[model samples]
Target: MNTTTEDTDDRARRSIGARRNPASQEAILDAAEAVLEESGIGGFSIEAVARRARAGKPTIYRWWPNRTLLMLDVYRRFKNARGFPDTGSVRGDLIALLQNHLLGFWKDSLCGTVYRAIIVEAQNDPDAAKALYAYQEERKKATEVIIERAKARGEVAKDVDGRLIIDMVVSFAWHQLLINRLDEAMGSIEGVVDGVLMGCAGYKR
Candidate 1:
């Protein structure tokens, strides 16, 4: 068969495998994550992922067109597996969310490594950048919901921009996470959340 025909056949087989066997998809993502953690972004390849996953190279290539897409899939899987936290109040919710995020980034070496790789890839790859943006947007929406709840409770100013506050909180936590360990950064999250809340509360709605 010609190259294009072979690629099409491989993709078809992969789709069938994924639909019939969800484990196969999970296995591929797990393997891709291992390759990323071990070799970083530049070293990722179908062969490395296949070897780690214990699947055929054709399977890896069939499921993911490239290493970046595979890594993206792995990230999605990891995020979903961890799930999200929800506390009653906005401050409590923010703290819980930030703490969970920090722990995930710091405790899991594989997660941290893959995240760094994704950041680097996003710097030069438009598709990766778009994916990162979408992820952030989703996070912002969640944060916004918390802020809106606070506003309804009269804990925060009605006119306050939740997106801006979310951005600031995320920026501070991200800097701390990147520069220091999560344990070292835990002390700052509460204060940061409180300060932002105070500022929003003071605003004349």
Candidate 2:
């Protein structure tokens, strides 16, 4: 058996794609993101992404294990790009975080498409559902941290139900994502936070 030089080089390239060239890894991720945005999860496949990225399917599999994992990574990066806000006030911070996320949802942003797809996938896939629940809990904790900070600063009522406050904000965010209306919606996050705080913390105006 004779392995030609061209075959040897091809094998090396396939085996070491992003290892040899970091740019290839980024290109693959970019292609994956595009595939997700254009086709959602149903149309996404390692072969399709490899074709779009000009990389081998093995290369993608080496990095991500499964389509869901890859998609999760892509969404993680997308969400991290904006991140939870820290605008010095709990109300302002909540508004900033929810507003940024909701605005993207209403615009049909790539992140929004991927996010909705993840939610639907979780409905039928237990593994996906676990991952989705974990991610949701992470977001819930972020909002909970804001409430705790308010409590420490004497901004929140000691008698307020912290757990309830967390649920209120998390549910409100999820509701907005589910409905996703964009027609002149004015200060929607502000409205949610104001109402919740008024009831939970006895906030003034």
Candidate 3:
């Protein structure tokens, strides 16, 4: 077989395109965020992202098998951009998390819309439901770490399961998001945190 220089260059380009490039991936993510922000979830699609990113549809699909996975990645980026609370106490941390991160992030038009769409999408799509569940499992692990810290300080009861507390708080936030009441819930976040604390510590208050 005679291999020409042009043939070698063609193969090299194909190889590069077949593998993921960090810069290209970042560009695609950036484009996805922009598309969602400008068009909302209703307008978000793989084709739209590909057009905005100036990448091929195959590239996007190669990196993310479906819209659910791509959307989750976009949501994860929004979250990873922010810092998690570490207020030295579980109560303080929970309150800060609600006030500073969860509520604040959900209050954003882009983040809130993406999350709400994901939840609604999950109800009808098995793949979306799976992706959401898997994503939340990772979040639960993070919550476990916070609980462990509280346990070390004797702030939480020995028998209390941290997952339950986090689930409660997260459920509250999701309800607020669904009801379009994130702003309203912000005022009551401290009380909510305290209630969860009471459960964890068995306090009379």
Candidate 4:
């Protein structure tokens, strides 16, 4: 019944990951986020997260396949903080959503840097791109929910194509991100949201 030193090391590595302790898992994510916020992606490393969370790097790596995968968790946390705006007016809701995104991208230091890092990683990593695009699809579905809500409230035509609306929004946001023109993008959100909604709300005679 003798256990080798290697067996002991293996058990230690698997213990945290295999036990499935929610608190420990959450702490790791929290630490990762804190590192990003304080130092951006430049300072985010396995050793840093391990130190901040007071857990071994092996434990963190076991849960997430790589740094990119772990970053997805961080991105999800911040994105979830601001849910779809439901301000009764479809136009108002969209304007609000656009404004928040623009401001976050331009004014929020932590958010801007972290998102930029993720986008850059997506450019080179197929797995990262897949995760990011899948998340984008999820968001598109969420936007459709807002569209449905608008229809329920009689603010939009029942025939509105939610997917088209989502495409427009996504394109505008990325255009701003790519061009580094947050000011213009922020100024144009109202116009863009209103103009597109014209079709959704139907033409008035």
- RMSD to native for every prediction? 6.2, 6.7, 5.3, 6.2
Candidate 1, residue 152: how far the Cα is off, in Å:
3.4
Worst 10 residues of 1 by lDDT: 12-21
Per-prediction TM-score: 0.72, 0.72, 0.85, 0.82
The sequence of per-residue lDDT tens digits that candidate 2 reaches over residues 1-205 is 2766676566555644634344455577788988877886779988889888877788788886667767876787677677677778878866765667555443446666667677777888887788888877786776677777777889887777776787876676656556765433435767777887765465577
In model 3, the runs with Cα more than 4 Å from the true position are 1-16, 199-205
Cα-based lDDT for every prediction: 0.71, 0.70, 0.82, 0.75
Question: Who is ahead in lDDT, 2 or 3?
Answer: 3
Q: Best candidate per TM-score, number?
A: 3
Which of the predicted structures, 2 or 4, would earn the higher lDDT when compared with the native?
A: 4
User: Which portions of model 1 show Cα errors greater than 4 Å?
Assistant: 1-24, 34-44, 54-63, 180-183, 200-205
RMSD of 1: 6.2
Pairs that clash in candidate 1: none
- lDDT rank order: 3, 4, 1, 2
lDDT of 3 by residue, 36-64 (tens): 88988889999999999877899889888
- Residue 149 local lDDT, model 4: 88
lDDT of 4: 0.75
